[model samples]
Target: MRKKWITTSLIAMFVLTFFAPLEARALADESGKVTFTKGLDMEGVKISVYHQSAPLAKENVKSLCFLDSYFLETGYCVTTGFEVGYNGSENSRFVSLTENYHLPIDLPATGYIWLETTTEDIFVEYTVSDYLYTRDVVYMDVFVPGQSVTVFGIGMSDASSLQLGEKIIDGKNIISRSSNQITFKVPSDAKPGGRVFQLVNPISNAIPVYVSPVVFNDPYQPSQWYLAQQQIYEAYDVFAGESEMVVAVVDDGIYLNHEDLSSKIWLNEDEIQGNGLDDDKNGFVDDIFGWNFLHGNKDLEVKGAHGTMVAGIIAAEKNNEKGIAGIADNVKLMPLIVCDTMGCDAASVANAIKYAVDNGADVINVSLGTSGVTAYSEVYNEVIKYANDHNVPVVAAAGNGDVNGGIGFDLGQFKQSPVCNETKSSDVIGVGALAWLVSLPAWANYGSCVDVYALGEHVVSTTVPIYDLEGGLYTAADGSSFSAPIATGVISLIKSAYPNISNAALHKYLTASSIEGILIAEDAFMLIKEQYTSADDFVAGEVSAVDVDIQAIFSDVPGDHKNVQAIIYLQQNGVINGYPDGTFKPENYVNRAELLKILVGGKGIFPDAAMYNNCFPDVKNDWYAPYVCYAKKEGWVGGYPDGTFKPDKTINKVEALKMLLNSQSVQLPGFVDVAPFEDVATTDWFASYAAKAKELGILEETGYFLNPGEEMKRASISENLYRLLTL
Candidate 1:
């Protein structure tokens, strides 16, 4: 009876299993839900459940384990086992099963799992996988997968040699190698999950690898506060300055061999080095790079740290993998040493000015100044005048003397000798120091003489090795000395971007486009704004509209004349004037008296009324008597051999050019040839002057003849004079 019962039960089980296939097929047809759970704080983990090998719904899961141990493989999910039997042939018996898992963590560990299901429910197979501890991992805030990253060890004992999962890192994986760091280009198959790197050289430990989205490799760019303040980087995005522009540093000797400055130093390719002869024959002998006026020699060996610092501020090479960037990175630094330990002499400064102007320097920086040397002093004044006449802008320090009467002594009530005077304002930019970009430094000289304000206090730049206390081949300095160079650098950048810009236009752009409201002084603030704003515009080749109205200022000037605008400009600026009848007398010849007044008045310099005691005896109470006396005193005019003033004498063309050029105390280069002029002879007294005028573009010939002996009409005078001022 028991055997009969067992047989009956087995037959019933076999009949039940055979008929259960229909119920399983109904179960497989019904859609099922999949739930996923992960350790605490384990975001981006995904699990999917599929039916018949079709993609199903995916669920993001988090773990319930402690956050600290989330990276470790903790068993947080309950597991159950179930069995299902196959009733068909061996190959077609089993149902297809696949578990798709994904984790968002960078360099996540992956493993396989097994699952079983019965007709009633499904079960999950659990397997242990590696974990990444956040504390053990060193990484940047963000990174793109499959990109390169430079990594250095933080707390790991042996970071030099590393292994990613059993794959030993070698030259194939590293893009570059250094003593303490390695740059690796992540493999293309790298997944966005936590990864473990084994440090195996000095000690055994697992280091987590994290990635950042971006990287900044320059070591010192972040510390350049002045560059940031001036928005130099933004300007750099448009233009980094051109290499052809040359900026002359007329300061103490510069460190020519500095790592950051050596490549940017101006080399005189036309002249041979150390030849002990004037190879180029401009003036100084053996000026291979630039002249050293202080020693009267060719050697640019740094005797003081001032020039080096100024040169670096103007142009220390950029993207060279070291040091801070200059405002104009591509500019050439022409070091014109004008000072030594004894300080700069007026003669040396003057010579340096001429050197910079005669050479290829596009900008001249005078970061040195005398405190009490009156602005009218001929010592440095003549050189500055020459620079102005040649269309080369000269930037000078407004003296270091504190005019506010603070921690330092003032430059006296009448400070900033030479540069502070009214005469220099037209061409010389007197710079004052600012602590930040907003406020003036306590020691910086201010007042009407200060043309612009620049970051000078605590300014960091390259200096001589002996003076480099910062150990990085650079040092921090302060004063108007640095501020002047900062302005020079800015001007150099503008000139580089717009090589065709006239000096007057360049000056206008710099003053007109500066930022406003930041500086203590209204003019200084405006200038600052102009410098920062117009630089990018100039680089973009944007032309600013002319704001001054020429036709309205001078009634005597005809609209048809070629220099009507220039004449109006001069008249509006008080440099020239019309006749008493409201007529410019454009067709009349300019008399000696009128010429003297125009030249003397153009500089904005005037002799004291009491000092004009009728030096010229021709006409004591003449209409031009005062001007004639002033001109005589200034050595700009003289009487005839018979001691006659000749106030109404009509000046000839050659005479007019000579007087105008001489008014600026300009010394022309040696006579080359007179071929430009058809009538002028090489042996004529004014031959060199005519040649210089042609070379300077001051005398544009309307015809083949240059009537040197003919009296110049008022129109020709105005046109040529405008060219002289703008050239």
Candidate 2:
């Protein structure tokens, strides 16, 4: 779409001709004449006028902004939207006051009329007002209680004192205050809502910051229902992963300066930027924010949003008061550009794969695919194989067909379709798209080749100027291209938690984690509402309901494993483990102390050991002291009447189930109206646990026998953990 040019001068002339007399009073007060920065001397430029009310323009209009599209540079004018100094009988509405790069308007208050030639430079001073001061924070992200958050805004340099309104957080402990941002922490008990921060000395501006009493908030996150459908919230509750792990996004060039993506971009510490020489001597010069393969240089020259959207889905910042919270975080995104204005070059795609693998990417995400034609490039096939050979898993999108009513194709019927066919291996996960209703789209490629599914349509993500045209912020998108990244983010979460995990192991986790069947939109909405209301944070329901087989990861366990999928799930997430000799020993009876260990580990709770030393008489200095004492302190366990924990005793079925449900955060019903087993009544001590387990199908006790005192074995524990973790 072409940029629209506004006839500002003509409109001003026409309005002046009709509304005003022949004589007009153009302001001759010329103390602050701003010379247009020499580089931006384009005549007859259009300016978007958004008038703000008196006293101050706030952060919404800071720092005069210029939107630079091809040949058209639109600058923002925050004013009265009327001609200046025209006091002629209140006739004219607007006039063309601008002439020869100089326009002066009276000061409504104290501020500056800053302008940018390009991205930066030039200022117009408006002096200061003795009666009222004008200052505001540029922007602030959602603040978590007891965590440091930065409040950035314009004109904070003169603030001598600061105060928070309504007693949300303490205004005393400021880490530091720059001209742009102030760093501080919110009180642990601050309630969620709008918070007013006043810069005092003489009081400038009181800006409202989004204060989240809970941990997470993103304006568009509720629209991001894919996170709910994919069980990403539950995965994050277990592990958010680490920043050391990297996922290389190979696609069209990304908007490096995107607000949501800038901080998460992977930096090449070895190379210096823009010196025109290869400081690292690896191959490319000035490869600071990963390589821009389009021109084989550091200049990203991002002309599209495909790459930015894909990368955002993989690693956009979470809980930021931005557009949307991306799936994965605490992981770096290596932008490996392989596409341009025309399209992606096959050879460039191959080179990007090699570069990503060599530079230590944990996984490679390719959203590009042969949409319509049955075109198979041997070069892409070789690179995919090369990536797998190096143990760098590759995830690609199954084709979204073509522009002519993109019909889904079963690539399994053919030998090679770069999107799906070449990606059926253990190291290559071919992804298909799911609609908002959790139903597969008719145009989404699905067959023996498409390995898994993720929400594709209406996926809200960070965007660039090309896609949005509004530029920056976010937009909802469709197609299988997006599904691949959501899957890639899940892989990123696992890889970040366990950097040493094998790609083949990740393949099993990824495949087994997904479930089929429809979850009607209304049911999902109601379930999510209850979870959010009752739970302290976001919770994701189970993804797949299919019973998955666990491979023999231990010497004692057979390849055709007998138990549910949780053993590998737990092991993969760094929750449970086997003996040093590689034996799982499934029959081993879980001791009281052992049960505490498993429960605590499953919850991903790691309290400081220093705080729990010698917590119990019999648990002093024991290996299980931390877990046992922490559990005891949380009221999940109690000591014997003799005041001894009796840590060595075997755990019974009732006790194990209670601990499992509590530690895993399974919500207890308000009232246990009916007992699950004939032997157990509503008044029984373990009735709630038993009922919850029965409702969730955690136990296979169809006969309704309450074997309350039976010893809980390692295998039974694994099965219980699986149901709780997965379900």
Best by TM-score: 1
Using lDDT, give the best candidate's number. Answer: 2
Q: Which RMSD values do the candidates have, in order?
A: 24.6, 20.7
For residues 358-441, what per-residue lDDT tens digits would candidate 2 score against the true structure?
A: 777878988885432235655576676666545578888876754324766676764334564342235367888875434556
Reference-based lDDT, residue 17, model 2: 9
Deviation from native of the Cα of residue 530 in model 1, angstroms: 13
Error of 2 at 519 (Å): 13
**lDDT of candidate 2 at residue 159, scale 0 to 100:** 78
Clashes by residue pair, model 2: 137-153, 138-152, 138-153, 515-544
**TM-score for all models, in order of appearance:** 0.47, 0.44
Tens-digit per-residue lDDT, 1-727, candidate 1: 0112111100000000111222222122111211121211112121222333222211212111211113333222222221122323231122211222222111113222222232222222222232221321212212234555554432233356666545566567668754334567665544323344555653223433432221123234433445544544345445544537888888787788888888988888888877777777787777888878878888788878888888888888777776656767568888888777766666777888788877877788888744333233446656766666555788877766533333322333555545653342355676777653245544556666666667665566777867555444766666778877777877776666555344545455455445551222223223333433433232111222334454543465557667786676555333565543346677788899888767765554433333475776675765466567877776776779999888888999999888878876668867656465789878788887788888777775756789888998776766676677665
Candidate 1 wrong stretches, greater than 4 Å: 1-218, 237-243, 369-376, 402-413, 421-424, 470-472, 516-546, 549-727
Residue 503 error, candidate 1, Å: 2.3
Segments of candidate 2 deviating more than 4 angstroms = 1-215, 370-374, 403-405, 415-417, 421-424, 517-727
